[model samples]
Target chain A: MGDIDIANDTVSADVVAKFDLPAYLHSQQAIVASHLESALEPRYPERLFESMWYSLSSDGKRLRPILCLAGCSLSGGDPELAIPTACALEMLHVASLIHDDLPAMDDDDYRRGKPANHKVFGEGIALLAGDALLAYALEFILLNTRQVPAERLLRVMHTLINRVGISGLVGGQAVDIECEGREDIDLETVEFIHTRKTGSLIDAAMVTGATLAGADDDTIARLSRYARKVGVAFQIVDDVLDVIGTRQELGKTPNKDEKSRKATYPRLFGVDGSMQRARELVDSAKKEIAPFGQPAVPLLAMAEFVCTRTS
Target chain B: MGDIDIANDTVSADVVAKFDLPAYLHSQQAIVASHLESALEPRYPERLFESMWYSLSSDGKRLRPILCLAGCSLSGGDPELAIPTACALEMLHVASLIHDDLPAMDDDDYRRGKPANHKVFGEGIALLAGDALLAYALEFILLNTRQVPAERLLRVMHTLINRVGISGLVGGQAVDIECEGREDIDLETVEFIHTRKTGSLIDAAMVTGATLAGADDDTIARLSRYARKVGVAFQIVDDVLDVIGTRQELGKTPNKDEKSRKATYPRLFGVDGSMQRARELVDSAKKEIAPFGQPAVPLLAMAEFVCTRTS
Candidate 1:
């Protein structure tokens, strides 16, 4: 309970100050990254393993996996049980990034201030790397997390696949691409694109951790609410950053959405309106965590941190 | 077991043999394709769904899923229990195909004599379609497969994901791409490439089905061997067909492997030698099933059928 108070106060303050999220996220990132490296070692053609590890180890915010760990911890499960699944989330996210950087998708040759996967590895290897990452992510979840109940594991699997699947993230991406350069795209269309493109995986990450902890249906539902709010808020922040932040800060080439003429929050809602929406969503997400008492404080603070940021 | 005999003998041989595998494959292909359609129904601009579905449902072999169902039956489980998992396998397989047809990968302009996914649906939708199929496949397995225990389900998951992951299909693909035009590449490299590229998923299909049916470890091992042999034989036949089969008969662009200067069985082993190896591997694979007695007949026959086919 005391941890909750400290996290709530300190976390929001730190975020407002733009305190180092990487530093905040570093130790766990190392842990998850190492686990991923170790998980992939038994396989062959060591170069391929190196390629995957190199792509993952590249600098970025470890938000999804960290959220997964937080979700599991909030549900009173050992973070270790969440480790593999958390890694899986990271891997899946990485896969999306790899594909997203291709010439046909974003056409950007740079990622994380360096050449994109396709640029450095060539389009063929880049494609294979993405496929490998996705396949391995599921493998990691299934093979690790040995202690989680089978039903719970199955639920995690379902959540993961559904979120990443066509109806969710993939479906969203397709529409986002199609809607590009189209002037008449509406709010509903934008919402559909963002929800599936980013929201589904983020929602999966939060709920998957709790599910692994054997959280009951009600708790699971609440956790999902928290995840949805945070997920949307995260994307809003992303859009805002594209409009306001620099490439050095954000890691990839900036203003991509605008340049691509893709629909964005700022285009749909003024910057201030989007900011307000993000804050409100974060608050709603925090409220969903109230029933968890103290254990969920991290999640709550994380939500607040999501919106109260500059970059 | 007696039912097996009845199915083989009493079932109209004409229907089974004269049955155009490619034609039959697409008829039920819609069932798996519909699964993707239903999942994405709620999206805005429903046109996105319509186009994505149009691309995926166009046509496919549906081999992996059918193999999964057949494998389950051979291991003494109801084919029905394997449906969801079969769907997953198909989704995963479809995902690979979608990506393979992309300009970044195989650079093909057509598949099944239709416009490629990227060409008709555009690159963004094509990428999304692949991702959607992959995710949907995993979800289908988790949600569907009710008869199996959780442990069995986990095993099935482990098999599927691992086979599809970097060390399996993806890894093989990377190596194959790297090996292109390397006339110096030897037989070991060729074997490594093919084994992981094709063998892993085939192994997963059979092993997962058997694991669900609670086959003993020994039986599981035998099934794996059977799958590996058939997978390699199938690949060899594919290589052979690339040289000899007609475009109309095979329903795909032929002789492209040689044109691409890709390493293949016919290139490494003379045509006659490749055919001989296919027979040997098939025979050995059938022997692995010898202990399963008559119940394993379909599996054994499938192994022979794999090598015997011209296409």
Candidate 2:
């Protein structure tokens, strides 16, 4: 049976009970969420800060930064060492969302069931706010931060930038834009676009967390594999939900992928095949965590959660 | 009479005879130029790198980075230690120029008498190239290939990011955009725009050079004063040139400022008053260096050069 099916049975309850994770998860959320808010406190232009904070404050799973923390924890390193870097990833994610919502791109009037940034902040300010957030994200990684080796810090920056740059997020975005209105897309194209659009930074986030904690090369390599599988599964689930989910459940417009005629797993592979592929990817991601044993439980659970999430 | 007038009539040959620069400058330029080229090499898309490098390699005075090197030399630091950072600033400058040239801002189709980045590279590529350059610039600093002291390396990054953030370059750009098309901008508004836009990075570059070399706070402060004077003077000359410079000499369309009716010193102060203020600023800038005596000769000459340059 798929992990999602198992999760719907008694196994998930046992996993949660065994881990005793509610308090830990809530505590981590509070800390991570507060750090994200504080990291975004604007030193100038109150409106820009308000706009950025407004979007960031909106409801969503704090998935990536928490995964960064989890990756650090799994490697026996302090999550505190990776907090700013994690926040940086969150900031970058928000920037992409803001830009993706532009009239020229996805043209979405709503995000998370609320008016999009461009809708409320004015297109120009929203555009600049995204740019400011991106620039500030890098600044957060490189400046006013505590101890990490200079060379390692350099690596952190290099990895983040590379993941966020053309070969990663932006390049994926270009292809995604081009993909709009096209009916012909294969699995490879979907994978290529998703890998860059989502996978690169997700990969960067987990790897950065581990690296910041001084994890060994092999451990980092494994974490990268885990992140990649999870990333792909995450995107697939998102695509599936857009086809099946209600607007209220998803907290945004439903069926956008279908309505836009955007290439997606459901459109390309049929619903069952898309579901099978997601499960396989999740299994592969879990396998990468096998050596980490119990310490890897959270990551594995997170991956399952990503694939099975209703919204 | 202007410094150029004096140079042509009385001191051109004698100045050249007495103050010929060492061969190190040529070597430094070659090394820095190579690092610059290598930094922007394309990865995913072949055309991306070429588009980025084209503007960066365009002929113009690389005054800010060169000033960084000179400050490093004056502080008795290894010039090589300053080289990558020097290149980083140039990259940053190029990034700013790309963004500034967008249709939303200066709207210049031509820069340095050639098609602007948006005109040549397309807007999407131009935006990504600028973003990539900034990311790479910070990465270069953190890499610190020269083995700068850990504390010093941290300081250099702190200075650069702080000066480049909203309170500095980005903030300056926002204000400049706001000031555009306004006919009644105050002196304070103009000063705020110029100081943050041009002055902060220049000051950071010089002060960072000294701070890296272990210069005391007082000396770094003095260097800052020198940079501020020259930076403001440079902008004033740019403003003056917009009114009087020929297309060939300016290497850009000279009549845009007037045609657009952008706020400028020449527009506000008239030709003669703006020139007078620039000269006064240059004198005050020179006075800031009086304590350094002959050691500041190069900096003084640079100040004069800023005021006199047609382009």
Candidate 3:
């Protein structure tokens, strides 16, 4: 709290003292969870919806959606205006997770401490549910976003799709798949995979939120840089957690990355070195938005939270 | 050609005589193919793009994109304005095909006289390629569309996504999978499945084209009705061909649906009866758009093409 006040001169010490990051994250998470719950009501073809909801409702941190809302607020826009886009971000995240856990992909049996989507619904329905969720995320944003210009909405859509398409998340996953079980994987290759696989969507989440809130290009760019740092840091922490934490603590199988021989930050740098790198990234991420002062409090805290979080 | 002149009082006999359906289809298909060829350039992660392009460039009728362009032309908009969207429709169609051929779904080994996507590229890359194409379709539309108002583009996106999401293509597919091998499946369930699985995307193609061209509500609705009829008829013809055609002509294994004990139009109705039903649908589809006069000539010819097509 003292560091935040010292970093942003425009943020008063009193406000810093009163701000609670956990409470803010919890409240924002609740809002996103509620919106997601009401977004899809069970209809005909109950099985598909059931499978979709099963993965969507899993107990996990709603990190991407929370970042989106925080991005909106940091840009001096009403957080309420970003709810639909927030939910859409989570939907895309869950869709990717469901597909990633398939037998043909990562073959993970557990996710967030629950059976993988295919394990419960079988592979066919799980695949269709993922496809449905991807399309529905776009539909939900187009139909539900309000009080924003059409141009802004289109920009948000463009950013979201671009980050998720071939040049971003999908591209990263493809390269990662190709590199599996290879002994020649380097730090640069690992960074490339993590940057696009995890970092690109995080960039989209923040950039889209700020875009929706009418943030100028400079502000959006700054937030993007901030997000990139935090994104990589977040993944590094995940790697460290995977090596050092248990299934009960991480809500996933521990040491699975080692078993698969997948390249990870901890694998190359060891847990202590990787954690030190994550701290440096979080520090740089906070500095990127220091000029925004009071408006960026939540985002600054979120950057810190990335390296500190256990799961 | 004679029936076309008789069906529309506003179309002159001279115009009907000059309108060659095959030549027109060939020209439009060439244009769509050219556009699609240029849309995706080879980039990094060469294997992924190779897999995506392999399926996208397969030999098939460019029916959906042609319908979209025709829809735009019918609404008096420059067909060029709808070219990006036309390409996007084809991308979505190809993406669905790739997924539908997966081992967990249809388990198809051949498509369009060649190996299925998963057969050529492993199932994981095939799945990711499908995901990339789906997302790229949205990104392509947002990036390439010009000379259209942002509001109309949003509406078009909404319609495309809605039809492709639950209660449309995905919902239809879910039910189809569930009803497979069940003898008690009735005509109503089959219609319900076909309407969503096949009909919805076709409806989206035409309706989105009209919407982008500034068609009135009534005209868009009329075109949707026309699309729904042709879509069902198109599936019926596919069913008939599955029963009566060979692998050489169909470009896939014949009678696979029957082998799987899946319900189909020809399964419920004899091949002749299904063909007869398709003819009736084509006739009614033409009636729905006849009021558009000479502007609907391409679509009118397309309606006839749907039933008469041998592949």
Top candidate by TM-score? 3
Residue A30 of model 1 has an lDDT of 82
**Model 1 ranges with Cα > 4 A deviation:** A1-27, A33-39, A291-293, B1-61
Preferred candidate (DockQ higher): 1 or 3: 3
Local distance difference test, candidate 1: 0.75
Over the stretch A139-207, how does candidate 3's per-residue lDDT look in tens digits? 999889999999999999999999888888889888888888987889988988888889988999999
Give lDDT tens digits, candidate 1, residues B1-311.
Answer: 12232223322233335445555445445555565445444454465455556655655566676677667777788867877877677667667767777776667776766777778777777777777666666776776668788878888888888777776777777777777777777888888777887788788888887787777777678789988988888888888988898887676778888887788999988789999999999878876765555556555656667777766
Q: Across residues B1-311, which tens digit of lDDT does each residue of candidate 2 receive?
A: 01112122322323433553435345556677777767665655555666677788987567778788877766767778888788888888887787777775677887776888878877666666666666667676765447677667767876776777667777777767666778898887777778887898889879887777777776788789988877887887888888998888877778778887776788888889988888998878877665554445566667776766667
- Worst lDDT window (10 residues) for model 1 chain A? A1-10
Which residue runs of candidate 2 sit more than 4 Å off their true CA positions?
A: A1-27, A104-107, A141-144, A147-152, A178-189, A246-248, A251-263, B1-31, B142-144, B246-248, B251-253, B258-261, B293-295
- For each candidate in the order shown, give its overall lDDT on alpha carbons: 0.75, 0.75, 0.88
lDDT of predicted model 3: 0.88
Model 3, docking class:
high
Ranking by DockQ: 3, 1, 2
Which scores higher on TM-score, 2 or 3? 3
Looking at model 2, the pairs that clash are none
Residue-level error in angstroms, candidate 3, position B136: 0.6
DockQ of 1: 0.65
Would you estimate the TM-scores of all the predictions?
A: 0.88, 0.86, 0.95
Chain A TM per prediction: 0.89, 0.92, 0.94
